[model samples]
Target: MPGLSLWLSPPPESSLYRALQDLITDLAGSVPAKDAPVFYPHITITSNIPIECDADEVVAFAASHWAADALATVTIMDFGPAFFKKLFLRIRKTPALTQLARECREKYVYGLATAEEGDPADQAAVWAQDEFDPHLSLLYTNSWPFSDEQKAEFGAKVQTVLETHSTEWTGGLLTLVPTYRSVDEWKPLASQLVGSE
Candidate 1:
């Protein structure tokens, strides 16, 4: 299987999720107002792989390896927004999440490479190293309605969110995203996280 990566994202009730949604409403006035398909607010647990991976198998593997669900309490304790030209929120690495990522990647995902090894496009993904970046994307690809100064100000505002918002990873859906290399092509694969409540 290929195209399997874990994700940490907002439950509908999350403050951070709402804040970004609010920003989207604000930007609707000026910009075209669509988040990049893969750019919705999410922290990637893993990424970069071929597309033929079995979704159900990946989910089953993750559920089996995890410690019977866990505290969804997560925090983005560090600031200083970084982006690939677009800005994103970064978090200090936590052993719990890192361990979760490694187990899934090494056990389930790593083995799937051979499934797509012969296809030229798939081979590129198999050879590439997918690094984990614990982050929540705040903005991507000039899609927001804010001006440059506004963008700066928007980023600055999020610094406050990073500073004050400590969130509990309450039980929410386990989201799986597809990589047709486009958001339109990607679909969410989800399971309920055993929440902190």
Candidate 2:
């Protein structure tokens, strides 16, 4: 991989990820093609750098970049949508997930050169740094056809649904895999966590 960044997300059991997937799948079924792919359950901790790909490279990367034992606890309570009009499951646990996200965020700052803007090589973009407001995205829509009333009602409905079913996530597993551009695709690589730190 030339341009890559470490990503952090709740493990499979995280209510946040599961809820987000369901929400997006249901809503995305009606949205445009551009909107459907945005539904992937992710809270990108850091990005914007061009690097190389190799098992050795990633192993060395994990050794220097990844954190070994960090506890990530997050709760899904409120329903919120991203600026893109996609709804998300919000984290309301006073940053139970922030600590883990920070480790990944720092990896970007320290690992390699951040990618140049306008370069077609970048896989993701930086919206803000370390302001890891973790939310699981659920919907995507254009701004042109939305009104205040629609947004408010959508949020309220989503919040009500989340309140009905949210699960606790703990004992996280850290897996360093290649960042892929598509579901049926992934670049192969391995990561090793630095032991000396």
Top candidate, metric TM-score: 1
The runs of at least 3 residues in candidate 2 whose Cα sits more than 4 Å from the true structure, single-residue gaps closed, are 13-16, 30-34, 49-85, 92-99, 114-131, 172-197
- Residue-pair clashes, model 2: 9
Per-residue C-alpha lDDT of model 1 across residues 1-197, encoded as one tens digit per residue: 13645666666577766765555334333334454333455566666434566666666666555553443444442323332225555644555555656666654455554654455333334433345556655554445334668566665665565566655454444556774445455566654443425
Q: Model 2: C-alpha RMSD to truth? A: 7.3
Give lDDT: candidate 1, residue 82.
30
Q: Which lDDT values do the candidates have, in the order given? A: 0.52, 0.45
Query: In model 1, which range of ten residues has the least summed lDDT?
Result: 76-85
Residue 19 accuracy (lDDT) in model 1: 67
Best by lDDT: 1
**lDDT by residue (tens digit), candidate 2, 17-38:** 6665676566656444444443
